[model samples]
Target: MMRWLSFLQLCLSLLLILPLPLEAFEPLTMGAIGLGAVGFGTYFKEYTYCKFTECCDDRSIPANIEALRSSLNRYLFGQHIVAQHIIPALSAHFQSRSTSRKPLVISFHGQPGTGKNFVADQIAKALYLKGSESSFVSKYLGQADFPQAGMVDAYKARISREVRNKLHECPRSLFIFDEVDKMPSGVFDTLTSLVDYNAFADGTDNTKAVFIFLSNTAGTHIADHLGNLMKGGKLREDTRLSDYESLLKRAAYNLDGGMKKTTMIESHVIDHYIPFLPLEKSHVLSCLQEEFWRWDRNPDSQKNKKLIDDIIDTSISYDRTHGLFAISGCKTLEKKVAVAVNYS
Candidate 1:
């Protein structure tokens, strides 16, 4: 009678511990119940815990992708090219069943305040429940992490190990490297194998990971190209990816910075070179309106317009030749808006 009670207690414990629904468990024969319970408990406790977590599931991909698209369109100003190109690429990579030949590698190049970092954050928020704070998301700032050029070798090994460990733990990881232009040239070489096609490291398949590289390296080229296009009587809306992608790649490869002469560029490991174009005056206005909304202020009110006009007139600088593009982009607008809100 005591043995039967012990078996029932063990069965109840298993029902509580296992991730499966209660209905999945059935009456176990008392003959070998004790031994089976012990083995099952050990395996489920260790394996099922991780497998059932949010990290291991791709069921949220479609909903997350839709959320990402909505966020980008609603929040990100200017850079229609970025919004148009990135969505399709991301959808293809995440939704497909067959393993990708390589991880999705996107290098965002543009001037300051053109929404590179903002877009990256939105992508993270859309994909993970905790967004940028998710354990699976890793962000590295080039200047802060690899400040000294002399420590390139040590930085390489550390970053390589970190990437391997993260991918080993969760294959669907996102790595955002900001200020890549400030990182030492050789540091990216260490990441070559991790980003390449059919690559595996530390016994983990790296093809499921996503890497986003953000830099101000090609901002000038992007701005200049846009200026030239406008000068030739082309509307900014009509500008296409072809107009700036090759220029960005060449600038990234030949320019002096983290990406200069990096193997990633030379071998074409970077799948997309998305250019964040210089913000026009209208885009800056939209940004100011959004900032106003954040503060619960009426963006279209005369008082707000007066403040926004002052900001546009005094704080933001436009292209010297055409006065069409915002020189500093929307980078400085947030502070200006905050100051205006405080004073008014």
Candidate 2:
């Protein structure tokens, strides 16, 4: 395995290596506007690249499929998607005959970049191919608490109804609740009935369904990143750069530009795969000064390199101490994940 720098190089190399097609190819899949439809499915070309082609399932998986990857998807920069370990606990709740129990119910909460969306996307694909599916989006309601007078119940019913419809449409789907922590306590209690045994109104087999609750930095898991902010602006703490901070700020700033916007460099480092802080303006200018020289291939560029070299020379060495944050000069390892992210 290459260091983080190599990943950057790999991303660049792959882009260079891709074969440019002579003619435009039609996109493999098409979609429309519905909670039911907004996914990239059945899109990749189903080409047979092996000799024993019949053995390989010609069915093309979505390019985004990543259940097997052990790490957070690079695409989910600075987010805490549920690790594979937590998934099994939810899976355990559904080990019975489908007819014997109600579907499983689960909830998740976490900081903004803590991988909730990424985890949901992975679960959806897996369920599409294997199990039942349903989804709840907190953004559907206008308010964080969803206090729109019956709108919460309506959305809940709509999601439950959709789940019923989806069960009929596809035999299995993994129900995902995005931004679950944002829902009001009342609404969450109503939905969480399925999690508590005998809490369902019908007293049916709802417990059989797969259940999950995703929380970033919840309790001890969140103590480091979220620290006091989990108390909702009441608790004060010295620790910063948290998902809670990012989420609350987004909520407070909406379209006002008051909150610091999320950046690509912060996103990649937030994943814990790398440790990088968002670059300040001066840091960015210095970086640009260094990058300005990479463009010139002529010997006259020696001065430009020397300037960058001097800067690197005087700067604090990025060694084990730098790993305290999620970034480094080692941009050669995963050329893919690296180039995909703009750390500079």
Q: Candidate 1 lDDT (Cα, whole model)?
A: 0.85
Best-performing candidate as measured by lDDT: 1
User: Candidate 1: where is the Cα deviation over 4 Å?
Assistant: 1-10, 13-54, 58-63, 199-202
Reference-based lDDT, residue 293, model 1:
97
lDDT of 2 by residue, 13-61 (tens): 5476346562433344211212113221111112223222211121321
Candidate 1 pairs with clashing backbones: none
> Which run of 10 residues does model 1 get worst, by summed lDDT?
54-63
Best TM-score among the predictions, by candidate number = 1
Root-mean-square deviation (CA) per prediction: 6.3, 18.9
